[model samples]
Target chain A: SAVISQKPSRDICQRGTSLTIQCQVDSQVTMMFWYRQQPGQSLTLIATANQGSEATYESGFVIDKFPISRPNLTFSTLTVSNLSPEDSSIYLCSVGRRGLQETQYFGPGTRLLVL
Target chain B: SQQGEEDPQALSIQEGENATMNCSYKTSINNLQWYRQNSGRGLVHLILIRSNEREKHSGRLRVTLDTSKKSSSLLITASRAADTASYFCATEWKSSGDKLTFGTGTRLAVRP
Candidate 1:
C-alpha cells in the first residue's frame, strides 16, 4: 500500500487566479492521476501524470486549464488556472501501486472554492 | 464520459440492516473496485474484484461481479451509523491507463 498526501487541504481563491495542488506518495508509483468532483457529483478524471513525460488529459480537460507536472515517480502537481466559481470543486490525487491489481489510493483532497 | 453508474441514488436504512448498492458500466474492464468516502474527505478503497472473479468478501463487505452483465453489487451487512456516507464503484477499463472512472455514487444513511 502507498501513502498519499496532498497540500492545501482546503483553500479559497479569488476568481481569475491560479492555485497549484501538490501530491506526494510514500513509494514510487508508475502512474499518478488527478481528479475533480464538483458539489454533489461524481469524480471526474482530469489527467494522468506520468513521470518524465507530458500528462495525458481526458476529454473536456486540457493542460492549459489544468496543467500537470510529474517531475519524479513520487511527486506531482496540478494547477487550476483562471479559476471561476464553476471551478469550485474538490481536487484529488491518486496513485496506483504496482502488482496491486490496479487499486488506486487517493489523497485527502484539496478543497478549492473560487470566489 | 463516466464509465460507471450506480443505482438507488440514495438509500436510508436502520442500523443493523443490510445495504446494497449496484453499479453498471458501459465498457469492459480489467477490474472493478468499491470505495467509501466520509463527507468531503478522500475515498477509501474497500475491495477490488477482477474480471475473472465472481465474488469477494472482506469483513462485513461482500462484492459480486457479473462480467456478462457488466454490473457489480456491494452488500454491507449489519451496518452502523458510521457506515453512512457515499459509496462509489470505479471501473478500470482496458483502454484507459490504470486510471479509474467513478460513478455518481450512492448516498447511504444508516440510522440508529
Candidate 2:
C-alpha cells in the first residue's frame, strides 16, 4: 500500500483563477491519476500522469483546462485552469504501485469551491 | 451485471448491527477493491478481492466476489458510528491498464 498526500486540503477560489494541487507519495509509483468528484457524485478520472510524457486525458477532460505534470515517480500536480462555478469539485490524486493489478491509494483530496 | 453500479444507495443501521453493500460490474476483472469515504472526503482503501478469490476478510469487514455473476459485496459487521460513511466498489479489469472504474457508492449511516 502507498500513502499519498495532497496540498491545500480545501480552498475557495474566484472564477477565472487557477489552482494547482500537488500530490506526494511515500513510494515511487509508475501510474498516477487525477480525479474529479462533484458533491454527492462518484469520481471521474481526469487523466493519467506518466513520468516522462504528456498526460493522457479522458474523453471529456482537456489539458488546457486541467494540466498535469509528473516530473518524477513520486510526485505529480494537477492544475485546474480558468476555473468556473462548474469546476468547483474535489480533486484527488491516486497512485498505483508497480505490478499492483488495480490497487490504488488515494490522497485526501483538495476541495475547491469556485465562487 | 452493468458497469459501475451499486444497490440500495443509502442504508441506515444501528450501531452493532451488520451493514452490507452490493456492487455489480459488466466485464471480467482482475480484482475488485472496496473503499470508504467519510463525509464526502477522500477514500480509504478497505479491501480487495481478486477474480480467482471467492472471499476475503479484514477485521470487521468481509468482501466477496462472484466472477460468474460479475458482482461483489462488502459487509461491515458490528458497525460503529465512525463507520457511518460512504462506501464504494472499484473494479480493475484484466486488460484495462491501471484505471479503476468506481461504482456509485452506498451511503451507510450508523446511528447510535
Candidate 3:
C-alpha cells in the first residue's frame, strides 16, 4: 500500500482565478492520476500524469484548463485554471503501485469551491 | 463514460444490521475493487476481487463477483455508525488500460 498526500485540504477560490493542487507519495510510484468528484457524483478521471512527459487527459477535459506536471515519481501537480462555480468539487490524486499486483492508493483530496 | 452502476443510490440501515450494495458493469473486467469514502474525505480501499475469484472476505466485509452476470455485490455485517459513508465499486476493464473506472456509488447511512 502507498501513502499519498495532497496540499490545500480545502480552499475557496474566486471565479476566473486558478488553483494548483499538489500530490506527494511516500514511495516511488509508476503512475499518478488526477480525479474530480462532483457533488453526489462518481469520480471522473481528469488525466494521467506522466513523468518526464506531458499528461494524458481524458475526454471532456483539456490541458489548457487542467495543466498537470509530474517532475518525479513521487510528486505531481494539477492546476485548475479559470475556475468557475461548476469547478467546485473534490479533487483527488492517486498513485498506482506495481508489485505482484497493481493497487492504486488515493490522497486525502483537495476540496475546492469557486464562487 | 461510467463503466459501473451501483443500485440503491442511498440506503439507511440500523446499526448492527447488515447492508448490501450491488454494482453492475458494462464490460469485461480484469478485477474489481470496493472503496469507502467518508463525507469530505478521500477513498479507502476495502477489497479487491479478481476475475478468477468468486467470493472474498475481509473482516466483516464480503464481496461476491459473478462474471457471467457482469455484476458484484458487497455485504457488510454488523455495521456501525462509522460505516455511514459512500461506497463505490471500481472496475478495471480488460480491453481498456489499467486505470480503474468508478461507479456513481451508494451512500450508506448506518443509524445508531
Evaluate every candidate with DockQ and list the scores.
Answer: 0.72, 0.70, 0.64
lDDT of 1 at B26: 89
- Give the top-scoring candidate (DockQ): 1
Interface RMSD of each: 1.6, 1.4, 1.9
> For model 1, how does the per-residue alpha-carbon lDDT over B41-65 read when each residue is reduced to its tens digit?
9999999999999999999999999
Task: Compose the digit string of candidate 2's lDDT tens values, residues A1-115.
Answer: 8889999999999999999999999999899999999989888899999999999998889999999999999999999999899998999999996456757989999999999
Per-model TM-score on C-alpha atoms: 0.97, 0.96, 0.97
TM-score of 1: 0.97
| Regions more than 4 Å wrong, model 3 | A98-101
Docking class of 3: medium
Q: Which model, 1 or 2, shows the larger DockQ? A: 1
Stretches of candidate 1 off by over 4 Å are A98-100
For candidate 2, write residues B42-64 as lDDT tens digits. 89999988889999999999999
For model 2, what fraction of the real interface contacts is kept? 0.65
Model 2, residue pairs in steric clash: none
Residue B77 deviation, candidate 1, in Å? Answer: 0.2
